[model samples]
Target: MTALTKNNPFAASVYVYDEEEYARMQMLVTEDVTAGVALKGDEVVSVFAHQDGAHPGVAQSMLRQATALGGRRLDCFDTVLPKLYADAGFVPVARLTWNDDYAPDGWNYETYRRYNNGRPDVVFMAYDPSAVGSLYERGAGKYVTDYDDGIAKTQAYQAASVGN
Candidate 1:
C-alpha cells in the first residue's frame, strides 16, 4: 500500500488491493480481479479521480495497476466514467437506476437530494482480465437497479402540509 499524503501531490489516495481482499469484493460483484483499487467499502470501485483539477490519466494508471496486481475485472459506473474505464479495457455490464420521487428511508437527510434532478442514476461496467485480449466477448447486461445526507438545497420549497 502506498502512503499517499498531501505532500504526495495526488488529489485522492490511489488504492492497490491485496489478493485476499480483491477476492472478497469480486465475489460481491460476481466478477474476478487479478487486482484493483477497492474504494469506500467496494461501493465506489474507482480507478480514477476527476476532482481538484487533476489530469484524467492518474485514474487511468490506477486502473492499469489494478489489472497488473491480479485484478481480473474492473467495476465502475456513470456514462463519463465508463467511457474512460472502457479505454482501459472495461465493458458495461448493468445500469443502476434511481428515482428521486420514491424517497428511501434516509433520503430526507442527505446530500442525495441535491442530485435529485439528476437523480443519481448510474451505469455500472466492468472488464474481465481473462477477456482483455478479445475484441468481442459475450457479455450480459441488465437494467437492474437499486441512497444520503441533508444540507437543505431546496428545503425551503418543501412544504410540510399537503394543503400548502
Candidate 2:
C-alpha cells in the first residue's frame, strides 16, 4: 500500500487490487485464499486518510485513479463523510440502516441518530455522471439513470439545508 502524501499532513493510503482476486475473496466460502475463485479485471479497493478535516482533492484523485483502472464506482459507508464524497463528485443514491449486518452493534439506529443529529442511515454515493464514460462504452446509454435528476435534487436539498 502506497500512501499519498503530496504535502498534506494527513496522508491517505491507497490499495490497488486485482479484480479477480477481490471477487474471489468476496466469495470466500472458507478461510482459505487458494480456495477462492478469481473473477476478472482490476480495482482500487480503498483510499483512507485520518484528518481533522475533509480532503476533497485527495479523495477526487483517488476516485479518478479508480475509474481510470476500470472501477465501476467508489463505495464509502462512512456516515460522517457524505460531504467529503459529495465534494469529490459523488452523488447520494441510497441510504441504509446503521444497524445493517455490515456495521457493528455499536452503530445501531439510536446511536446513529444521536450522533448524526437525527440523520438517516448510511448514505451511499456514486461517482459523478461525467466520470461514468471512463468505465463504460461511449454512447452506451448505460450510465446512471437518475444522474441529472439526482444531482439537481441533492444540490437543491443541500442549499436549503445549509446554515440550518
Taking all chains together, the TM-score of candidate 2 against the true structure is 0.40
Model 2 residue runs over 4 Å out of place are: 1-44, 52-57, 100-102, 105-114, 117-120, 131-164
Tens-digit lDDT track of model 2 for 1-164: 12233443222212235555555532211132111111123222445543422543344555455545443333334344455555545555544443344443233354445434433344444555443323221121112333344334434434553435
Model 2 worst lDDT window (10 residues) = 30-39
Error (Å) of candidate 2 at residue 131 is 8.0
lDDT of 1: 0.40
Residue 12 shift from truth in candidate 2, angstroms: 16
Worst 10 residues of 1 by lDDT: 148-157
- Superposed Cα RMSD, model 1: 15.5
1-164: candidate 1 lDDT, tens digit per residue = 22232233331223345667656663221122222245333233535343432343455666665555544333332324455666665555554566546533333324333433434444444444443433422232355534111112112112221125
